[model samples]
Target: MNVNGGRPQLSGTFGAVSSTHWLPSAAAMAVLEKGGNAFDAAAAAGFVLQVVEPHFNGLGGEVPIVSYRASTDRVQVVCGQGPTPASATADSIRRLGLNQIPGSGLLPAVVPGAFGAWMRLLAEHGTLPLADVLDHAIGYAENGFPLLTGAADAIEVMAPLFETEWLESGRVYLPDGRPPAAGSRFRNPALAQTYKRLLREATAAGGGHQAQLAAAEDAFYRGFVAEAIDSFVSTTEVLDSTGRRNKGFLTGQDMADWRATVEESAQVRYGNCTVHKPGPWSQSPVFLQQLALLDGFDLRRMGLDSAEYIHTVAECAKLAFADREAWYGDPDHGDVPLGTLLSAAYTEERRRLVEAKAASVLRPGSPDGRAPHIPEQVPDVLPPSRDHWMNQIRNGLPTVVRAAEARTDTCTIVVADRFGNMVAAVPSGGWLKSSPVVPGTGLSLGTRAQTMTLEQGHLNSFGPGRRPRTTLSPSLVLRDGKPVLAFGTPGGDRQDQWTLGFFLAVTEFGLDLQSATETLAFHTDHFAASFTPHEAHPRKLVVERDCDPGVVEELRTRGHEVELVPEQSLGKVCAVGVDRERDLLLAAASPRGRQSYAAAR
Candidate 1:
């Protein structure tokens, strides 16, 4: 390891894998050693992450994938985000006497999409069988893996609720009527059995690889998994963040009706590289927008970690994210104006908004002469005391609190193989603390619907069969028409900010992959967040504690409400890149959480 506690960068010609956890990184490398391609390895790693990092992701969550296929010389997005139930309308939610969706429980459940997305990626691009890719995850879930400290604390916080309300969750998380201790061996036999049954159903079809994959998808959506979720939601009324017990709106038909789709990526050209991100349905294009705005600036001269660089980036991020709140939504449901938002004229106009000092307001630009509309900001009604389980749930995985908050963010996976395939995926939601686990499946539904607004006429208003604008964004960068880097981080609403800083550090500052991943980062919460009870803190900037005191004082002098946090508390960025000039592959993982790791041959 380096003196700064970060691992040494790994370089090779064979393959590389980086993720937020060590088990999945190693498992992905194991798949690559077995001659599977990047897609196969990523699928394997994704499943392992679900089992090992249950606090960050599960089978019932969502994942938005951006991949570059060497064969086709194409980059495409696999949209794994599920839509709201057909009956979950704004009026219906209002009838429940709630102003905003709860941050936890069944009422916010969306159709589980992560399993289908993984199956789709494997079926299309992978050279390995489904059974081969799934065996490692099954082994971990059946046998056991050492429980993480973060996971242990989450279970302990929710222990009271488990013993009283969500009994099924208690049965799985509290195996002996108590929360398991950190570093102790823990197993989820129910989840293991769930995957076992999926495989059994797949193989029973007795066909080729594609047929078996199709069978597995059917088992999860139109079959037993769907049935289990429907039965539980239909019959159960569990307590939620609203201080009321309510049944969910999801149905078996919703699962049967939805399937992950493959769409073209929204991209922007920055110098020699072309960066690709998921479409407007995600908060992805905000990254591209920031790149567009920064293309006019001379960041290299600003100097890395200088007050000027940090202020410029944070200011640009505020404007870009302001547009995200005002205009981004599911394009299939309404107009997103993405083409105009990324146009040169709009970018140039928006770039002029960044000043020498931080601006203390949300300012979304007009694209194509359209007026911008923003939802009403809701103030956070935090519990009177931290003893409430709802308080813990709000601070749990998939949610990023403000300064000095818990470290329960999300998870990321980036993989590359010698075959030239590259993949970046952010798999999150369906956290253990987000909802109660289904009895037999040992998995819970995601609260992604809470990210959507209930206000009518908003771009991201709640509606039937609409994908909520999610914070999960992955990035793939290509140089000279070939994939060179796959990178992303796990920060709710701040994903783009952290990843953009990493990309610039590597591209402009000439830092190696490891150095870029380990660099100190800063972000601003200047716009309304995408999580429940959307709140904003105008002009607030958070920097790592290790930042130069001179720079901190300079930022404070320039109108930024600067707050300092531990050096490693900001970003959990992971990256894998190809050095075509050297004919080598490189990988790096953040040392922030001490859990992220990178593996290479």
Candidate 2:
């Protein structure tokens, strides 16, 4: 009867299925089906993610989870992303001119505590035994899970970065003298050994939930892994002296002080649906604010493919992203005016400046202080035209065949049991081959440097001890004081953007979860910011095929840099649903992944 038994573990109302790279979604749902709560399912999935989606998540990554209590209707946000070592400093990497930090794994990497976050969640909400919850992962690592297309592609492209640098990496990734192919079974005995030791240590400590998590955190920070990582990092030129990034002095003390915080949600109410996202760690809220301002306009009147609609949204996106570039950063270190940015008064003022049926020139500048009066519309600054957008497909698109799809993996698991408990979790920003594991302990440290800006003082600028701005946003949608939808995506920075669009399609457009999620779309900045667009997709509206040609030409006339890409190009979302009225739970992974699926009861 154990979900962790030899058969494929699964749970949920509709049975779990998905396109996620991690196999843990099935394990978690199975835990719930076998009488485990959402927490148990999440823990089971968390453990499996470490085994199957190893390059992205492990004992060393960070986690941010969203939980909804069915009884009290309380929604809680748990910060899962870990912080930089206390000793880290911005000055340490000054010579690299900040750019080193953005593309950096060696100089700007921080202490990852994804497992620390998971440990806390499981201890607080799980009913299954810790060892039992970890069984699916252990089995996979001991036996082997095939390298699906997504993960394999990543290895082929990025493995050279690791194989040439670390021996252990070369061994784990190139066991047969090449990266594992799709359907080629892969096992990680080293990671299994690490998890085994950690579980044993946690179970032995014996304590309440908080204490249990604390004990597990201790296992990695001050125990065996710490000693090993400290030695490995110091001898290598991975970090600098301050332990800010791959500072040469990675110490147990640094890892011990690493903490994850759960912050309040940034909320947007459009009609009956209230969109929610974690505070400034991501750019989702800023986008939401822009959407609220645009609510007063008639998007349908502008039409779907009209140049007016696309240009309006594009300009708004540019403005929002500019603010993100300027003011978004770790809240602990900087003052982000999130409250003021989303204020209705400011939104109303912004709405007033829009030109009806036309486009305006976009200037990159910070929003001014709140003004008492709405601004007059300035005309002819930028000319707009009626450009029709070609919808490649309104529903689903044929994903472009990609040779680069292999380097990524992520899993999202949502749970709602009879008790009304709900959880949404997405792990790892996908360090992949960038971050090498610590010898013996398999400590795959967080490689968050990739998401941050290297420019000095930019909100997302990389600093020694600051958490990098990430797009890994796990969210919960509460309707009528009840949690209705819980979801997240796995496309690095694409997570927040895609999530914001889904929230809008559902709340503003009145679509159901499936309809909302299935809506083919373009990212806010299109391909300007998130360059990983889907030009190869057959059904999605990408820059190349669907822009009505006239729309692109018109936009180009206005000084906008437009390119074609597919909506599902980079961000593949995995979601779980709860139809509380029907007493049904729907769990499904994206079909994009060859091996991904959901099994629930």
Candidate 3:
């Protein structure tokens, strides 16, 4: 009955695995136990998450990874976010009488990017073969595993749509023409076959580990999987969130032309600690911005769960997120003033907005005399929500509507091995409810195209072969040039906000990993969302119900539109930290959803 009741900090001298799903956590630990390093464990864990948490992620999703190699003594990023199809354009959507990309459908489909990223990680950094790492996921998919109640309920909720609009999905998810009951064994033999064929193709190529990994990547993008995806989307027009039937623009060529890229980690130093995140394409920089703004305040003096601490952090989040809307996007698209935006002077100038009360306006600083590119109209098509769509899957409880809107959901994985290798990855997109299952493949195309904007000249504007500005941001932290932490969560817009809270809990309040994760978290919907319509609810703050009532009252008095969420229902953060000085690996997973797990030793 303790609100702070999460698994104790999982400590070990060998290795650790923490993930959004327990099945994957166990899989990763098993891999580590088999002498695989962090990359191998993470890759294995990520694939397992795709199979078990279909409502959240899949192989068809995107996975952005930040990893540290003990040999290289460096942090690197794998940009798994896929670009729009060659034919994707605003005019094309306009021709279909749509102003924004549909939240769910084929029209918003992008090149499946996760499989490529995972393969690349395994090929470049992992010691295990593609077949060894993937066998764990294939086993569960083929032999069957217990379905989470939330995933089962999701299938049930969408049964009507799947039955009539997305028959392919109905066949894949509801093999018996009915939703799989929670706790009942559910199998996806199609996906298992798909993995088996990929492994066989790679093995048949007769090559070394790297070459075989290359063959697996080739097989997925240039072989059968791509053909199946292309054939289904090219011929089938399915109903989507836009209330219309539409076919996808993705082609085999798009998948072939697209591959995950390696990039330098975006970083900012705060009090001897350098936090690293993916580039402008993700909402990660906001965490750094928040830290900069908070540098002028005495967070520890205010206390961890104090009203002043929560209010100040929430206000800084608003300012940082507002800038995310105005500026953050694919850096390759055009010039992004990241240097000026993350500058200390910029934070000092923007820091003045955080007064005693919440500021309701969207204020993005004009950096280097360039006016911010704020969207003119933000339709609240599917506004942000804290609804527990997969509550049953996580809690084995009935559905509860906490909000009136929705967006894409994701999952995360973090691994640390005895050799000092570490990895943090957020694998997302291709939610079962987001799009139809590709016929005969048990794979669903991602709707990441919804993250694009229609505004021409904007960094996130819809364009062919341009990566959409994604919300899938993972973070890695280093102290004294050594990898110390690898962590992330699955909340779309709330990802950075919650991550910042966890970081502060460690650095400022000195809470352990488990305690930090279980600490009461609050989120603000004051800035634009990354999903379709990109709705913004100015001054809105949703605090966990377990948060002190006095803090809630204080926030309300400070001009915040306070909404209380049920206890253990906000962010699902899973994190792992390495304490080399003590020869120990520490890990923690949020109990909010009950599915997150941490395994060590």
Better of 2 and 3 by TM-score: 3
In model 1, which residue pairs have backbone atoms overlapping below 3 Å? none
What lDDT tens digits, residue by residue, belong to model 2 across residues 287-400? 566667667767667755456665666555545554555566788777777776777776676666554332333323334552221111111111232311011101011111
CA deviation > 4 Å runs, candidate 1: 1-5, 379-387, 394-403, 406-408
Per-residue alpha-carbon lDDT of candidate 3 for residues 1-601, written as tens digits (9 for 90 to 100)? 1335546888998888899889999999999988899999999999998899898888898999999999999899998998899998889987876667776778888989999999888877989878879989999999999998778878887787777878888888997899889989999988888889999999999879988988889999999999998888898888666555788899999999988899999889989799999999888888888888999999999988788998999999988888888898889878878888899899999998889988989898899988986876545343333433322211111121234322225899999999999999999887787788887788888888887777788887888988888888899999999988989998888899888888898889878888888888878988766665566789998877878888789889999998877776777889999887887999999887778999988
List the global CA lDDT of all models.
0.89, 0.58, 0.84
Q: Relative to the unseen true structure, what is the C-alpha lDDT of residue 597 in candidate 1, on a scale of 0 to 100? A: 93
Q: How much is 501 displaced in model 1, in angstroms?
A: 0.8
Q: Give the range of the ten consecutive residues with the poorest summed lDDT in model 1.
A: 394-403
lDDT of 1 by residue, 374-458 (tens): 8885644544655467665553245423347734377999999999999999999888888999989989899999988889888
Instruction: Name the better of 1 and 3 by TM-score.
Output: 1
Model 2: residues >4 Å from true position, as ranges?
Answer: 1-19, 96-99, 159-163, 207-210, 238-249, 300-309, 353-411, 453-461, 524-562, 566-570, 593-600
Best-performing candidate as measured by TM-score: 1
